[model samples]
Target: MSLRYTFINVLVSIALLSSCSTPKGITYMQGMFEEMPQEIIQQSRITVQPDDKLSIVVSSKDPELAEVFNLAVARHQVGQSITNNNNMQQTALFTVSPSGFINYPVIGEIYIAGLNRQEVAQLIQKELISQNLLKDPVVTVEFMNTTVSVLGDVSHPGEYPIDRDDLNVIQAISKAGDLNITGLRENVLVVRKKDEKNIAYRLDLTNAQSLFQSPAFYLRQNDIVYVEPNNMKKRQSTVNGNTVQTPSLWISIISLLTTISVLVFK
Candidate 1:
């Protein structure tokens, strides 16, 4: 084949290969319409896990009586006045141990892992009533550490607190400062733990319709959302602080060599 034809083929190949990510890939919810029916997607429930910090509050009609079953939170000096203590009232945060149990004031150590926030509160309330400690105890439980990790190719990659229990993948991405321009919008990875093993789910944000059907649609506490970098961004990244040639670089090098040979041989 002629050198001119070879060079043309080389240039065309580079141009085609360079188009790794297109404008369509960058656009989110492509082909979506205003008349499209919305799908009902249920948010995942966050279960209490080991090392989870929980705030449990016990309340009843008789304030003095309820205080007996509650742990005294030392907000200030122990000898502080009642008014000062009231102003600084704070529930003592309970940290679930590795064994999935918390040392309660009266019930001693009780397993709480794998239980939801409401179920945990109900368990405590039942214990109080069963022990005849209180006629009817009202217990409230809230997760003090409902955070999700957003890492890789994101504007802000770190642990973000999820105030709402019904958080989803889209919300998690928004909290991470949204995916950067370099992030691979089509391939986002969600890492979750189950049965002491890690399970990863891939989500395509470019297709909003399919995203609803994704298993990672609802984000669980401590779930990790990893946005991988696209080809362009991967090429820009350095290896060990040293510049490395990506596939495009090698292709460019070959094209240059082929063109040089064509001119030298012509």
Candidate 2:
């Protein structure tokens, strides 16, 4: 074959091979089934932890008698309107001690760490009714500092309050304005705390159907969700798109090499 024809053929073959190489990790969830396998994960309720702020409010038909059981909220009167305080249920801010106890107005020190919100409220209510302090007492418990953090490739990354007890990774991301387009859906990270130690897990969310089966699907209080950037964002592109290098520049290099080879062979 003539040098021009042979060079053109070689260039075409190189272009085809490069195209194949570029698709190695260019796509996510390439062959996922529509219906994912169902795995049973025991949904655990969020228990109280050390350093958590709690607000306990006790009430009954008589507001005067109930006043003794509850503490007072402290703050500066913002023109006697409202104060910039968190909405934990405590009339006065009560910090859970390291020993897992809080000293109440009349109940004294009550060990509450590791118990769910309902359990704590029930315990307090029982104590009051048994002691004849109040009849048909109603107790309310609030986790004032229950929050989760969203970071990395999300649209809005920050700590968000968990109004409800149960939260999932998907909802947590949604609270932070969802993940950006460049985020790697298949490599979402969840960092959780257990026994005062942090543990991390890698979750694949590209196949939306399987997100429910992930171990990290249900997030705990103070858990952090970090969505990493996809390979496209890591790439350095010039007009073509993001990535290591532009395809046109690579093609030019191949062309120069081919020209050199043709000259030597000729």
Instruction: Provide TM-scores for the models.
Output: 0.73, 0.74
lDDT of 2 at 25: 34
Against the reference, the lDDT scores of all candidates come to: 0.82, 0.80
C-alpha root-mean-square deviation, each candidate: 5.3, 5.1
Which 10 residues in a row give candidate 2 its minimum summed lDDT?
A: 22-31
Candidate 2: give the clashing pairs: 55-89, 55-90, 235-243, 235-244, 236-243
| Model 1: per-residue Cα lDDT over 97-197, one tens digit each | 98899999877898999898889999999998998888878998999988999999988899999888778888888888888887898999999987679
lDDT tens digits, residues 1-266, model 2?
Answer: 38766777888797888778743332444446565566645665678888999988989999888989888756556685866565632377678998899988777899998898999999999889888989977999988999999999899999999888777787888899877878878888999888778899888875555566667787778888998887677563335465335687778878887787677766
lDDT, model 1: 0.82
List where candidate 2 sits over 4 angstroms from the true fold.
Answer: 1-38, 74-90, 207-210, 235-244, 254-266
